[model samples]
Target chain A: MVEIESMVPIAAVVDLVLGIATLSIISRSQGTSANNRIVGCILGWILVFLGLSYIMTSILEFRYGALADFSAVDRDKVGGTFAFTAKNLLLSSAYMLMVLLPFFFPFRLINREWDLWFLLAGVCVACAVFTAMHLMTNFEHFQVENFLFIPGYVVLISMYIRFIITEARDNDERLRKVSVVVGLVLIGIHGETMTYWLSQVLSINDLFFQRQSIQSGLSISAAAWGGINTRLTLGATAMLVLCAGEAWRSFKVGLSPFGVLTFIIFIIGFVAGLADLAVLDVVRSCYETQCEAFPVAYTIWYDFTSEALVYLYTPILFMFILLHYDIVDTKREENRWLIRIIVILMLLIVSSTILELIQSFLPIPDMISSAALAIVVGIFIGWEERIVKSLIDDSASIQETVPDFALPEIEHDFASPRLFNLVFGGVTAFILIVSLLFTGLGVLG
Target chain B: MSSDDTITSRSLLVTRESRVPTAVALLVTVVMMTVTMVDFVGDLRATDTFTSNTPDWNLTFDVQNYTMQAVETLQDDETRNLEFDMAEVIIPEGYSLGLIDVTITSEEEEGISVQCDSVAGDLIENGLTAQWNSPMSNLSGQDSSCQPIELSLQVYPDFDGRSITVSAVNEYQAMQHWLQDGWGQGVLSVDLELDVNSPLGFDPIGQDTDEEITVDVTVIMFKANISLVE
Candidate 1:
């Protein structure tokens, strides 16, 4: 069986391109409403953070091969390497942005002038604290920052349920738009975990971790293991809640595409849970006997669901939110061509990656697959205008849609895209410098 | 109603319009967070005290051998050779071929006047996936006085012994690394030559003219079994 290729490269390239494209759009929309501008900047920066993190991850994978294929000990053995350390730090930085994103987007919950400072400070403090803790503990406490996701999860989930309830109560289609945005944000953040919902609920995920620990010869501290379980529990709970929320909304106000997306994810989780059960022996092989290779089919299942969600679909989802919701001022005439280019470019790239993945498993001859790719490319090119127009035509900013629900703008002179770029840009440089220094001095690894 | 009381996103959770969903959200988040924090804290405490009960892994090696032997008759001044096709050696599941040994023997009874003719065995490394020139490998063994000459080669690198106890394994253990195909493979040849040193260096009768030679080859295969040290 062909091995599943690494998705870090795909995630890296997609996030970087989409992020830069988004920021460029935001930079040009200087006259937009302050709330939308801030939201766009935050989303853009989140993507950039994720992009840079994935880039570091790609570098690490290139240097030491896939982390999943490595035993835990070997994972740590390479963990001390420059790319590995940089990758984790960069990821933690991305997570910090993700954690703060909910408060800004869909609706700026923390709308005061100083709330902006709090966010900047949160990112800064999180960066310093996490960097110190990881180094002090030799990266053992890296996952500890998972606790930080709780606030974001709580805000997103709460906003989602609240808005959906209001939307149904008022029969206001505008409010449904808000709910959909919140749901998309929820899925974007917790999608991978959501796919493991069944396994997490059944605690089969714990067994898998146990097997990994035993095989890697690494005994994680209770704290670290707890961190892992915490994240899993959050994902599991979020999945259940999402499935419930989506089903209720669909029943109340005919199904939306977002509802269908949630159900599909729910189904994937159900199947994934069964698959995890089917391979219980393989997962427990290390604890009971010796470790065994997971069946190729099981691995392929993971590749399509969890791996694809994280590496491919999440960016697409974000792009949808950006364009569909008019987060980046997509209506402006000058910006139309660029948005169209990004939409088509992202679609093409994601399509090519999926085709490559299918070709890896299916017995399609190279010529046939190439032709299939050509067909996809042709179809996308033919429908490029329609796709871009569909995304841009009905776009309305959250500020414009649910004005009654919006909190009054607390600051007139709000932060600009430049300030965020400058701050996050500095954070990136700092991370790279620290990584280089620690790696050079051999303080890490 | 009050300009100063316009609820921030943080405060809107408990506001009149959203209190119910906010409470439910808080409750769900709280329950999961509490359960997780407890588990994490307990684990953290266990680790900080240096009393972590991380399970000990015990790897027991099940040692077994795969052997092939051929007996040949060599007349005086006869050079007889036997090629042992190592491919015939079947490795059981989870077992790896670790060491290969070739023993060449010549029969020299006390009454026989054929004073153990110079017997030599050469384990020619035709195409074997083994450490052919290992210091432990006696690939070329010669016994002038008819002692069973032995030729040894390690099938895989650093294959010390089949019956080993690996107290710990660090990632995709040597079990996966050491288990490879074509180990101790290829055609192993043992060359035997007999020169009867009769009482006067002459054999009137052909009694001392012919000798029976035994070429014995053994392949040691090993499998690993793991148990918790606790």
Candidate 2:
């Protein structure tokens, strides 16, 4: 029997490739406007940090068998293994980036000028405090520190909603529909987190238990349930459906072939990942009594396939952003050829996943399936290189232009600069001092 | 210019004054906050009970003693057995019994061991049996065994003003081969201890009574077994 531990390295390598591709694409495209640059750079770093975190986590899990059973108290008293500590540090950094990137992305988008030094400093201090807390105590023990990250993301989503609503109000009927759909998709993606935060504030277990009870009623195992609940899976699925609807509407109104192709790839990846999770959920739920009788290798394959699909959606989103922002405008002929290549690569990835799923049921070796996936990924990397080269070559001749994003002008009261600085500085310093005092007390105790 | 550009320019020209959406958002947020606050307050109130309504009392068992003789019959069967009252529990007037518990402890000497596999009482049908190996060995004075048994009583109206009498039996039988070999001899001393407790309590969600009272009773038992050679 093949151990699940051996699969981690392959997964890590795949994530590493994805991270490199994202960074490479963002770097090569070097947005024509300041706002685009800020958004692209922040998002690219977010991807890099998240990818590194996952790679580290996978390596730790591979070496330690599985760290799921270890408690925070166990990690603290024993000082954890070196692999575990490094993994925690990377994960903490990833979470810190996750919170920071969203705030900056929206701020840069809304304000043409990037002059939020004080806000950036506050965020930096908060992230530093969180990192320290996570290091001193394990993630499980630092619930307060984990929770502090939520408000930033919540504010980010709220800003996006406000932007969408404003755009919907001002735009034409077609654009309005698209804006509303995207707004709903954003809400759906962030709904679970909002519900969780509300439940925590209300001190109600029922809010959490309701989801558990529904899963239990369906007889879904915890692992399958977790896959369904994961933010990446849920968010990607919602976005894929919404984007497909938008694409259909765009087609009726005559959209570019490139837009249709992007949506098609997005839909295919989402469906493939969702189908994998659904099949696993059904099989595991139905055979709850005899789940162990099911083949372990197939389970691992499904897990990897679902995870890869979810991760693949990130790059696809980045591509959508690039296209939407008009940062990487391809010539019509080149765009058509690139679209064809993308469609083919997407099909290859989907087929590879389906084949893996089938091999789990049949007594077949995975060598061919693995090779097919690797070859497709290699082709994908080469295709990405071609696009990057094109984008770079095109960028040199194209002059930077003013961004077209509109901001609603509103009259509001304003505090004097000196007063604002004094108050903000005082509050931030007080918070920092209190945090340091508590941390020192904790260490001494 | 595109339709998007036209809409943007038009929107920019008009001084946007619509507040319906903003009002709606604020209203929703306020309602949600109010509901959460109410729930938290309700939880706080539920936990702040200064005194409990349930009645609490303890019943102790007194010590008692008995003797038994083991005699071989014509069939060559040697047996000895004795039964005695362990405790009597009475519920106070206008009060109901919420729970009843009986505890038993036994000890014996090196040559003989005492085991109580079952107990019988008025409140319980037949008796409760030890679900495990509950023999008490007195070979060492430091070793003794105690078991707590809960009487399964019907809920509500059935347990009102109820009185229960409890009893247990200790039996010793010599091996037929030992009797046939004429090896039965000497006296075996066994000590038994018992305690009964019943609390007359009012259900928070159920029927309430004005009177709250406590009753305590104690009982004990001692037994000796004699093995005589025929």
Candidate 1 off by > 4 Å: A1-4, A69-77, A211-219, A287-290, B1-166, B169-230
Residue pairs clashing, model 1: A72-A216, A80-A445, A222-B43
Q: Give the best candidate by DockQ.
A: 1
After the best TM-score superposition of candidate 2, give how far the Cα of residue B107 lies from its true spot, in angstroms: 26
lDDT tens per residue, model 2, A1-445? 1223332344344344444443444344432344344444444444444455456556545554443311111232223444444444444444444555544343332242323443345445665675566545433233233333434434433433343345444543323322432333243223323223322333342222222222222212222223223332223323333344346545454454444543554544444444434444333332221222224543454344433344444444444444444433333344544434443454454455445655655656668667767887777576766654453343321112212433432211221233333433343344345434544455422
Report the C-alpha displacement of residue A162, candidate 1, in angstroms. Answer: 1.7
Q: What TM-score, over all chains together, does every model reach?
A: 0.76, 0.43
Task: Name the 10 consecutive residues with the lowest summed lDDT in model 1 chain A.
Answer: A68-77
Cα lDDT listed for each candidate: 0.76, 0.35
| Global local distance difference test of model 1 | 0.76
Error of 2 at A402 (Å): 10
CAPRI-wise, candidate 2 is incorrect
